[model samples]
Target: MFKIRNIGAILLVFFSISLVNAQIKIGDVLPNITLQDTKNNAVKLNSFKGKTVLVDFWASWCGPCRLANRKLVKMHDKYKAKNFEIVGISIDTDKSKWIKAIEKDKIQYVQLIDPKGFDAKSAVTFGVEALPATFLFDATGKLIAINPTESQIITQINKK
Candidate 1:
């Protein structure tokens, strides 16, 4: 009985470690997810496949996410015409709060709500563990960078 218990504990630890390590990385194709926008519109990631996309995982309650939203708005305004888009995927528990933040931030880019916290299908596919996480993809729909700052986004767009 003791040997069985010890084996079970080891299995549990290994399973947890694997779960935490399950993550999307650079060069991985972005998974197509159909999440809802504030308007209840179905916004599919694959819909904007041709353009270089910046996928930002954030939540209204997150202070850093709020700051990142401000920067993302600026970045969107600057490079939108250059075939770049910033897609804000909110991990907010409340849809109303997510919409309010979008209005308050004047975020012009695409926004989606993930009310299931980080366990939402989109976040799971992207393996997002924290707020304000970002993934940048190129025009060909290939991920180029992960967790890039606003300045890094600007530089990447300019390089294209």
Candidate 2:
């Protein structure tokens, strides 16, 4: 009986480790996910397959996320013509507050809402344990970097 219990514990630990390492990694293809905009319009991530995309998960209450938006706005402007896009996914449960933040930040990128916040299935799929998690993918839909900085994004885009 003790041997069986020990074997069960070992299996549980192995599965836990697998789950911890299940996050999408660099070079993995971006999974096509259909989320919605403020107007409830369906938007698919793979719709922008030919453009370099940065999928950012943020919340209105997160200060760091708000700060990141300020920098991302500038980056988007410089690379918009180069087929670059930033998809801002807000996990804020309050729709009004999320919209206000977008306006306050003067964010012109494609904005989507999860509304479920961290409990969202999309959050689990993206393996987002914290706010300001970002995945930068190339024009070919291959992830190039995770939580990339402005310089890193610039370099990756230039490489393509």
Clashes per candidate (backbone, < 3 Å): 0, 0
Model 2 error, position 155 (Å): 1.5
lDDT of 1 at 46: 77
Give per-residue CA lDDT, model 1, range 1-160, as digits (tens): 9999999999999988887666677888767789899899998887877888999999999999999888788778888998899888988999988988999999999998878997888888788888878999877888889997667777777765
Q: TM-scores across all candidates? A: 0.87, 0.89
- Candidate 2, residue 25: how far the Cα is off, in Å: 1.1
- Candidate 1 — number of clashing residue pairs? 0
lDDT of 1 at 88: 87
Question: Residue 37 in model 2: shift from native, Å?
Answer: 0.8
Q: Rate residue 140 of model 2 by lDDT.
A: 93
Model 2 regions more than 4 Å off: 1-4, 7-11
